[model samples]
Target: MTASAALTVIQASTLTLDDTQPRVEAVLVGGGRVLARGSREEVAALAPRARVLDHRDLILTPGLAEAHIHLVAYGFSLSQLNLHGARSVTEVQAKVAQRALQTPPGTWIRGGGFLLSELGLGGYPSAALLDEVSPHHPVLLYSRDLHLSWANSLALRLAGITEATADPQGGKIVHPLGTLLEGASELVTRVMPVPGEAEYLAAAQAGADDLAARGYVSAHTMAFEAPEAPRALQTLAARGELPLRIWACLPHERLAHARELGLALNPGGLFQWGGVKFFADGALGSRTAWLHAPGFADGSGTGMPLDPPDLIRERGAEALRLGLTPVTHAIGDRANHEVLNAYDALRPLAAERGVRLRIEHAQHLDPKDLPRFQGLTVSVQPIHLQADGAMIRELLPHLAKTSYAFRSLKAAGAILAFGSDAPVAPPEYRATFAAALTRRDDEGQPLAPGEALTEEEILWAHTRGPALAAGWADEGIIRPGARAAFTLWDRIGGHAQALVL
Candidate 1:
């Protein structure tokens, strides 16, 4: 029971992947590392007294890693009003009304999961519809993509948003109805009371537990929530209660504060600081994706860019010097190109610091920019391909073949770290796998079938690619000296449950 001693032997149909194939009777564990991994006899001779934890016929692979997730925010969202699958405006209204009845008047009723397209609306829905459902309570519902939001009149009024209110920078207010897009959603959010320490801690726990339940053993939590979100996670890690290993990013705005606090890259058991996240553009669903020469195919004038490369370059170096990876949100071609340029300038420095610069969406790429992802981690959500396909065809037809170009990206030598981008897309790997492998959209239209990835490729992206993206070399692979984190199942890439450690 000393640091130099080994204690347990885990036997299974090991997916050591140490040599790219599954092993039948591997013995591993007890040193919190792979103490020994080989035929059962080989490992037993090395440490016969090691307590045995047998997985008789189960398949064992490296623990799955969700490269990108908004942990605390996702957790809080789970308990909030869920409107994710409402097919129509009426369905949304009915759900909001039902939730309102369950809560006292004047309490803020917040939920998300509505798709503007699914609502059968050509544009953003108005606040008037929601007003009719919860006139006494304030309500704000985010689009399934998290790019747009629909709020009731009361909520709009509380946020001081009116017909005369001008759209904020990088965001738009849909006319006549009071729905907000991109940056505009902040208007309503700013007025909401921040959760106390307890609330944050609880939400963090809920979110982490939910992901673990879905078979994720580690995650890279993007900074999209209050600072307390990560603080709550830190609290859990300190207590050794965090079930999944976490790599968290700080918002770019917080870089100076982190620097001032002397915060640097860290590994505190189940959690660590991995990067700083910035937004170069908004999302596709909200119509904020920054595009190329001839913007959206529908003529929306290429989407707007949120941050300039000049600024990203200036701040990115500082981030690297402090051991923080620079991760930017780039959904459109233009957005991806600009981030790539900035990263190109910082790549050498990033390498020197052992950091890997990353692009969060790399969803829609320009053919020319596709090659830029080589050696860089492109953290993408294949699940969004279903909903984005129709919009891609309608709004950005020219890039259709290359959009969500997993094959092309991989061929270009890019490290594709697949994720659900949860809260934006649900945290379901099966959906991610199906979407990437099938390339099927909501209308059953197959988009870029040639770009589809195989099931094995998809699994590798979700596991190894993400671990590499998060800079956790000790994870995502079943090998000597690697953490004992893993997911076991009756079958691989199918219905399964997390193997409790």
Candidate 2:
């Protein structure tokens, strides 16, 4: 018998996420899709001779999806220096020195996950500390937010950046030459060796495998990486080596090029390009999130704004015309305000095209801007609350009540999609579950208790919300003809394992 045509009956305790028949005792599968879902007796009678796989002890939920992640980059980060919890510069130096001890003198070393505030620094960190540890090897490390980069002198010299090097548009070269903010990072990244096709393929495989192991059946790959990143993923799909279904976006600057190449929203596959991405501002940790007056309570000037709202407004319409979702990254109040204004202009056209606009990281918001998110896909990483909670209280206390407003956004008519933005944070759903349900941050402090969501709501955000955002009708639920992909759990929000037919 052909493998695709083989029949089986899976008996389990299932939450279908379908209002019509939310609970199912047995599911009949054939050709990699669910053929029927019903009581064990009913389905058993229909597929009498089908092989039976019983797991009545476990709970089966719709497979999870990482709503926002830089897949390939995350894969590569698996081996890079991880600095997620170092509380002091000395701690970071020790780790860098160890890595350098094992590496060749001239090899470049890279890794990231540090937060300035977490490190207890009031201003930018000097590269001298890193230089002291690894003067022979160039080192480049990114902050946990991915909005800033700290490099040692050797790395900076290699990038040809000095006091004479002017800041690139939309980026900054923090004086004293140790850190690069926003656009300024590109200067060094551009100078770094581009990964060849093989490295890209390896990263793609490693990333997809890691997520599959964590019970993610799908992911929406964000578009901050180079073109090779997507191409590598496409290669995997073509070779049938891809383990997770991918819905990816391209940077908005590629919109004209995309139109020329006739790339648009094409659904139905292991991979698809469904959105065009834009960035309105940087992240809060970097003191670069574009904000309204009184910006950061720390007295850092209003953060740097990246893409102009006019550009998002004009180009967003173009993306919608191609049946593509215009996804923008808006972190601070002013950034969200400007993006909401820009999306307002696209609303009519987006409605006409039957498209849902998306906003990534609606992290901190003005009360006035909260309601404006209604009807948009607010794709956020609940995992961020674990670290960002304390920072919000210290840096932007004015918005604390509304920051990461999960319940408020959901009540306001927004489709809340959860993700981890991995590499910045590990795509661990347990952390997501805890952070979302508790509304607490790193220090065991609650930021906005009222904004906490129930476990079920968090599941919906990680499943159905992302499916709807990607315009996938058959995923995020269990029904006849649905993809035969599920996540088995000991109980709701417990240990998970993927079960894809």
Candidate 3:
């Protein structure tokens, strides 16, 4: 069909997710928007000459949205050495050695997605472990959670991190040298090579295209990478090369820069600046999650708090004043509690500014603090449950009941926005559906079966929840005035593909 076709009709077993008309047999789209949706004959009648494509047995739903991700990072991770499922130190060494053989000897080797626990490590791994594999290359492998990094001696020396090097504020250098936790990872990162603008653009494009191919129409890119990451996405969007809508966040550290540049929340377009992201604590896998009293049963200390409560409070108000949502990452119980406390104080300001307060990865929480999430956006990643399940049971046993409490959060009046923290976990919709719907761990055991959600609820969280979080009125819904982006599925959470009419 020509690009200027008057209309295109798609017929399927459709789930519009529009309360007014929940299900439709066909939908008519034109001008990149839905024109009408109804029974096959009715939609066809509305657009007599419309190009019709029928898939009567397939299920259709609003385009999926990934509420939290590091878009550019995910793209880069695609090309890096994958260590996602490495089960032992030997497996990790072998992977690094194989990559080392392919690369220049002195080049920096970077890759991640391995859990220490999964690697059979009783504690943080030393640089000596990676050294055994790639002694010539400066190797820097991030923990699965991305909160911890296992660096080789070469990399550590390149970053000037030694046994005597003091830990930076908000992060730790595990004793005996090699592992960096929380903000401490920056010690090496700052020394690692920075990708050029063109590289950044290519990474962003790759990431967006990857997500689009997997049926995502939009993504809320959490700001955890360099500024060039979002800049690249913006560059692609301006050139009409971006495949998915991007709602990006500015690093809270860049708040001053954004404010000085008069940047506020800009809501439409393929790419938009929507919020400022802050980390309240590190991640669970890193043993850096900020927990309440009686911390990890394994005694790794009460997790490392990243951004201080006062910082979130003061900077969050500034972000609210600038009409930007204060999106804080709080995976630990204490992290969530502290962030909720800050949000409680900033709620009035947020309301006055017409912005929503958002908490990313409210993974673990205290039962009493669940209600505090009321009227706020809770952006979570069910995909994480697949990996964190056993860790949660072992470390935060006391809070295990409320960890990833999707049902409880929803019942407590919180808006549920779902996402896969790509690179941390693959942005696979099926995995998200399975994790949320089954509440089953990697071992097929339920962590908290009562937290299981229905297929419809999971669909809403993946679609509408992200829309609300990004303040997009036209996306994540199938209606007359909405964007004509949809996902066709063989079954509710089965194989799916994106369709942009």
lDDT of 3: 0.90
Clashing pairs in 2: 171-183
lDDT agreement with native, every candidate: 0.84, 0.92, 0.90
Task: State the local distance difference test value for candidate 1.
Answer: 0.84
Q: How well does candidate 3 match the true structure in TM-score terms?
A: 0.98
Judge candidate 2 against the unseen true structure and give its global Cα lDDT, from 0 to 1: 0.92
Per-residue alpha-carbon lDDT of candidate 3 for residues 1-501, written as tens digits (9 for 90 to 100): 333347899999989888999998998899899878899988877777888888898998999999989999999999998998889999999999999999998999999999998999898898898888889999999988899999999999999987889889878898888899888899999998889998998889889999999999999999889888998998999999988988899899999988999998777789999899899888889888888878899877887887888999999999988889999999888999999888889989999988889999999999999888899999999998988888888888898899999999999999899999998989998999999999998867788889999999999999989998888878888888999999999998899899987
- Which tens-of-lDDT digit does each residue in 38-108 have in candidate 1? 88887777776767778867877788888888998899899988877678989988998899999999999
Q: For every model shown, what is its TM-score relative to the native structure?
A: 0.96, 0.98, 0.98
CA RMSD for every model?
2.1, 1.6, 1.8
Clash count for each candidate, listed in order shown: 2, 1, 0
Model 3 residue 490 lDDT? 92
* Candidate 3 residue spans exceeding 4 A from truth: 1-5
What shift in Å separates residue 60 of candidate 3 from its native position after superposition? 1.2
> Which is superior by lDDT, 1 or 3?
3
Q: Write down the worst ten-residue block by lDDT for model 2.
A: 1-10
